[model samples]
Target: MISLGGKPLDIAAFEQIVLHQKDINISATAIKEVTRSYQFLQSFSKDKLIYGINTGFGPMAQYRIDDNDRKELQYNLIRSHSSGMGQLLSPLHTRALMLSRLNTMLLGYSGIHPETVQLITDLINNEAYPCVYAHGGVGASGDLVQLAHLALGLIGEGEFWFEGSIQKADKVFKKLKLKPLSIHIREGLAILNGTSAMNGIGGVNVIMAHRLVIWSTLLSLMINEMMEAYDDHFSVELNGVKRHNGQQQIASWMRAFGDKSKLLRKRHEYLYDKKVTEDVLVDKVQEYYSLRCVPQILGPIYDTVLNTEKVIIDEINSVNDNPIIDRKNKNIFHGGNFHGDYVALEMDKLKIAVTKLSMLADRQLNFILNPALNGKLPPFANAGRLGLNFGIQGMQYPATSTVAENQSLSTPMYIHSIPNNNDNQDIVSMGCNAAVMCSRVIDNAYEVLAVELIALVQAIDIRGISSKLSPATKWLYNGARSIFPYFKEDFAPSQKMREVKNWLTETDITGHFHKQL
Candidate 1:
């Protein structure tokens, strides 16, 4: 069970709740705070003008709303703002979105009723997920349309995905013996006005990106063994001189994973008095930059992923709603806490970093495929006749295409903010777009890694060097090879790639090597 109060939500705990169906409960203090905020807001009537409670939202804030229509106005706001397009978010993403929004409201700053909060908890705990769309959030105004769709489910109006089918939320709520949530004075606006959508999606992406880093490091180690790379590139003595944390950490990981490999050579052993004869052709003094600079290149990415996690977690824990209700101080502060630039910018950086990681994997895969460059491996590591079977040659096309797509998607979404909402929402932050794009890059990167794993294992098998691989590298190689065997013939790799990718995501290869990272 995860407690929602006072403390920030960690990604690990969030994963348990989202992926494992862990139960959730609001803290007693959070309950008390919510009640207090709601009571304070009740003191004001429609006659008394307040930002989200009485007046219209955005530029319409200048107009005063009357008494009877206030509740209807709240309801209408959700219906109007629930405009979303494109593909729907997965159930995992919807649950994460709900969890973030619910946590924000639990801070007791959104003036939400206890019933409203409970309803959100009910949906999450009971595995009733709202169908949140991928588009419709500008990232400023706190993913209005996306969260609005989420809020729509609470009112028993929108569709929900339950038990593997799309059903009416109203019918689902009834079957579950739950009542539709009644909107109160600031409830609808409070739900819609926050950065939870982008933060939630980006939060899960952060976890996935971190996993990708671990996978990249692990895969690079296997490639290192296959290419017989010099161990000096990952030496602690060399990295310590550089004084970069990520570089040093990566170097340490490489040592931990690659040190046991029989194929790796010490730099001094190969470099000292080496001659270039036909029998002793020293074609390379050191590995290429992709193999040699894994630490330097991926080290920064490691730091960036961790840093982005910090910002996203902080956003998840804090209240981002406008006109924050401070009942104790009897004050209301309307500010840009709802702005998603923090999440957007960090997500953009993560996308760029992860895409670069895919490029590294692609380059390394190229090295292992080329006979001239890959330590004299066969063209495509073909065990059979070369022309009859194109080994891993066709696989490179998708990896190259994905890297190109990642580069195109890496354009920063935050800088492309377009003005909307009658200029009231001018200078918006496209955080949701960044979050979506980041997820796409991460998904594509997974395929790239999966393909690279296939090629690397083929290289190991073709070279008949499985006996010489380090324990860790062999474990990963065998784990993958078990699911997808060596491609002696030019069979379609899509099925094999999918199985490998699925296994990688489900297993704890990254967690097992946590100490290294």
Candidate 2:
């Protein structure tokens, strides 16, 4: 079990809990600190005017509330703001949001009761997800609408995704012997006012994007092997001249992956051995940019993914709510810690990087399908008679269109801020929107890579070079063939493409390569 509040959660621990469904435990010291903060807030706010404690929230903060209506005011805030509309986030993302929120609360700065953290922990361990919507968060004021739905479920009034179906939160709570969160002080504002929504989604996006970079690098090497391209492009001597760490690392991975391959050619052996005697050379001197610039193209993407991971982990561990309850200083400080500019900017950068990766995959797929380009395989890599059957020709259109869609979606959401909340949040950050769009781009990249993998396997078979592949590429070829065998005849590729996509997402083909980094 991963323990929270003792130390900040890193990407590895977050991945294990969110993706692998590992359980969590709260530290004893953290629980004591949380109780101390709660007690301090309760006593300190009896006479003073604290925001969200006696006064209203956001633009309505000027209106003072009565002592008797303070507890009911919290309930009203949660109920009124539960107006999110759109598709529900997948259970994976919902669990991530829950974990992110729980971690922040355990910092003992939210002034939330210890019972609130316990309920969230139980919900996460039980796999009972709150129904969080995709649309309603402008990412300003801490994803107000989206988190309101999370707060709604915590109060036993909204829906819970139980056993892959939507059920009443009260029903699930009763069935699992879990109690709903009670309104102790500002639990509504404490739950709703934070950056956890965007942070959680952006964290998952960063993880998937990291995996995409690894797969992209592997595929780039495999294609070079299939085409028998020159090895000088990714050589240590060539990339070591560049100052970028990402480029050097990618070059290293390429060298390691292609070390055992029999298909790669050395430049000195082919060209530098002797001078050319013919006017028209039989061998092409260099490959297309897509095949030649693997390090340069994917290096920035690698750096972007890693940088985004750091920013997201920092956000996850930060106390991102307003009115931070500092018991040590014996003061309650109100500020805009709830703003999401950091997450918004990082998500935007990540989507742009992932979109470019998809473009590279699409171009590589196009290169393999066009026989005129490589002068090796038949048109469209058709194994059957040219006129009688079309091989993988129909699959290229979706890949192209999908990459185009990703390109259009890569426009930055950070710059598209619109004033809302009566202009109180005039310069808001659309962080959640950026995270969601980045996720779509990552998903699209997977589809394109799946198509490219199938075509590469077919090209390998048509060239009759399957036996000469390196161990890493050969393992990929065999694994892909198990999901989709060598297809020469004209057949529908929709189902086969999906199977490969699922395998790519579910499988970890780059573990050994990842360790080298």
Candidate 3:
């Protein structure tokens, strides 16, 4: 079990749990510290009002509640805010959102009891994934609707999908011989008051974006080696002139693949090894810029993932609760720790990065499919036989459209905001929108990557790169070739591409290399 405090925790570990792996542990010391914060908040009688814990939520913040009605207040919040509409998030996204929200509260500054955190953890560990819808989160004043749905599950009033059936949480809890826990005044506020849903979707996208980075690099090399491109373009001496890290990295991977090409033994001014079958010829297409500029284009996006990871780590490790307890200072301060600007901007950057990659992939697919542009590569998905088979000509149409759609969604939601809740939600982060939009970007990327996979595999086959592929490239190419079975006849390519993209997402492409951190 991974140990979490109101401080250090592992994101990868959290991801595993959200994906239905295991539970996290809280150190006794951490639990006690959290209890201290909880008790201090409970001691309030009068004059020491806590904003969310004892007061009405959001625009009703000016209203206060009597202590006797505290329990009803929390339950009422959950029941009322459970107003999210539309289809629920996918099981994957829902699980991830729960994990992210729980981990955020694990920072222990939320003035919630340790028991509360433990119950949430227990619910996740037991596979009681509550129903969380895609709509109803404006990302300010927290993901109120989403969190309430989650809370509703815990209180046994909402629905859940467990053991492959849609069942009530109360039924499942009882069948498992467990009981849903009661809520305290702050419980609803604690869970619903942050950017967890956005973070989770963005987190998964970050993971997938990371894989595409390496895939792009590998693809550049494959295209270069297949064409017998001049090594002069990728010379370290030449790349050093530009000194762009991603460009240099791409140049290195390309030349390295070129070094391993079956056609060429070595660069000029060097002795040629005797490993030659002179079958390779000049590539008439010369490969599009999309194929060649993989590193210059996708590398900085990799760098963006690195920076975004850092910012998110800080956010996750932070005590993001309002009314932060400063035990040492013997004081508490209510502040705007709940704002999602940091995550929102980073997610926007991520959308820009991943969305650009989709368009880039789409561009390459277009170059490969168009006979006019595709060199000797067969027309439109290598339909080997011409008129009888369209061989994914239609596939490329939507793939091209997908790229433009992703580009359109890349507009930063953080920049656009409308005041809500009587200007109380003024300066909204709209991270809820960003999170959902990035999810769309990721889905579009799935289609884009799928199209590229189909195109690349087809290109390699037409150019006979498979026969001359490097060991690593050959391993991957052959592996994917088995799943796709060479696309000999024109058929729907969508399902096949989705399966291929899913495989890449699950497989750790980064593990194939040992590079500097």
What TM-score does each of the candidates earn? Answer: 0.96, 0.98, 0.90
For model 3, the run of ten residues with the poorest summed lDDT: 264-273
lDDT values for all models: 0.87, 0.91, 0.71
* Candidate number that wins on TM-score, 1 or 3: 1
Candidate ranking under TM-score, highest first, comes to 2, 1, 3
Residue-by-residue lDDT tens digits, candidate 3, 325-376: 5554567777777777888888898889888878777777777777687566
Off by over 4 Å in 2: 510-512
- Record all residue pairs in model 1 with backbone atoms less than 3 Å apart, i.e. clashing: 142-194
Cα RMSD for predicted model 3: 3.7
Residue runs of model 3 more than 4 Å from their true location after superposition: 44-47, 232-235, 241-245, 248-259, 263-287, 381-383, 512-517
Model 1 ranges off by over 4 Å: 44-47, 272-280
The candidates, ranked best first by lDDT, are 2, 1, 3
> How much is the lDDT of residue 199 in candidate 1?
90
lDDT of 2 by residue, 1-517 (tens): 9888878999999998998899998999889878888999998888989999989999999999999998899999999999988889989999999999999999999888999999999999999998999998888899888889899999998999998899999999999998898999999999999999999999889888998998898899999999999999999999999999889888998898787899999999878898868888665789999999999999999999989999999999999999899989999998999999999999999999999999999999999999878877899888988989999899999999999999999999999999988999999899999999999999999999999999999999999999999887887888889988887777788998999999888775545456555
